[model samples]
Target: MKLYGIKNCDTVRKAKKWLEANNIEHTFVDFRVDGLTQADIEAWLEHTSWETLFNKRSTSFRGLTDEQKADIDQAKAIALMLEHPTLIKRPVLAMADGVMVGFKEADYQGALL
Candidate 1:
């Protein structure tokens, strides 16, 4: 399994800790170090909708102007995510059969167990 997220993110840290405690082995790809390409983002966008992948609740989104938020369509949202990867809901886990985009202890236990 593989996990993609920034090292400094609290949610990512929690997810990593939970995985480790459970003895679930995973490769962590830090976006800050690995960096995502448009193609990679597009691939993820293929599996998950832009709305799901986009993090509207993030501070980065808050920093954007109302007009910018209003103008967010699929393409625009993709561009924004490409520019700022943090705007992508984090710790996107990719497993052999599925993907999970965030961390919740119970959900992880249910899905991973």
Candidate 2:
């Protein structure tokens, strides 16, 4: 399993802590430092829509120009996320079976535990 997010993000920290507490083995990829590939995003897209993965409320998204934010499609969203990974939601958990876009304790319990 792999978890992708910014290292300093609170949500990511929580997810990492939970995984460690539960003894779930996972590789963490820090988006800001480790980087992401289009294939990684594409693999995640198989389980969830770009709309779900795109974090509209993030500071990175909010910082975008109106022109960049307007008329967003899947391709546009993916491009934005590639350019600014912070625009993607926190703690994206990638497993062999599925990909999860965010951390919810209940959801993690249902899926992981």
Candidate 3:
């Protein structure tokens, strides 16, 4: 399995700890350093909608102006995510069959554990 998020993010840290504790082997892709391409974002959007992909609750989103936040659609969301990867809700888990946008403990228990 593959997980994508920044090393400094708390959610990402929690997810990594859980995986380690459970003996779940996962490859972590650090967005802050490794970076993500537009193509990668597009592929993730295929499995999950932009609404789920974008981290509207994050400080990154909070820093955007009201105008920048307005009239947001899938394409616009994708563009923003490409520019600011942190705006994309973190630790996107992916496999050959599918992908998930965020790190939820319950969800991980069901799907990963």
Predicted model with the maximum TM-score: 2
The positional error of residue 35 in candidate 1, measured at the CA in angstroms, is: 0.3
Would you estimate the TM-scores of all the predictions?
0.88, 0.98, 0.91
Output the lDDT of residue 25, model 1.
95
Q: Each prediction's Cα RMSD?
A: 1.5, 0.6, 1.3
lDDT score at residue 88, model 1, on the 0-100 scale: 92
lDDT of 1 by residue, 40-101 (tens): 77777667788888999999999987887896889999889888888999989878776788
Once superposed on the true structure, which residue ranges of model 2 sit more than 4 Å away at CA? Answer: none
For model 3, how does the per-residue alpha-carbon lDDT over 31-101 read when each residue is reduced to its tens digit?
Answer: 88998888888888778888888989989999998987999999889888878889989888887778977
Clashes of each: 0, 0, 0
Q: Model 3 Cα displacement at 107 (Å)? A: 1.2
Candidate achieving higher lDDT, 1 or 3? 1
Q: Higher-TM-score candidate among 1 and 3?
A: 3
Q: Note the residue pairs that clash in candidate 2.
A: none
Q: Give per-residue CA lDDT, model 2, range 1-113, as digits (tens).
A: 99999899999999999999999999999989999998999999999999999999998888999999999999999999999999998889999999988999899999998
Clashing pairs in 1: none
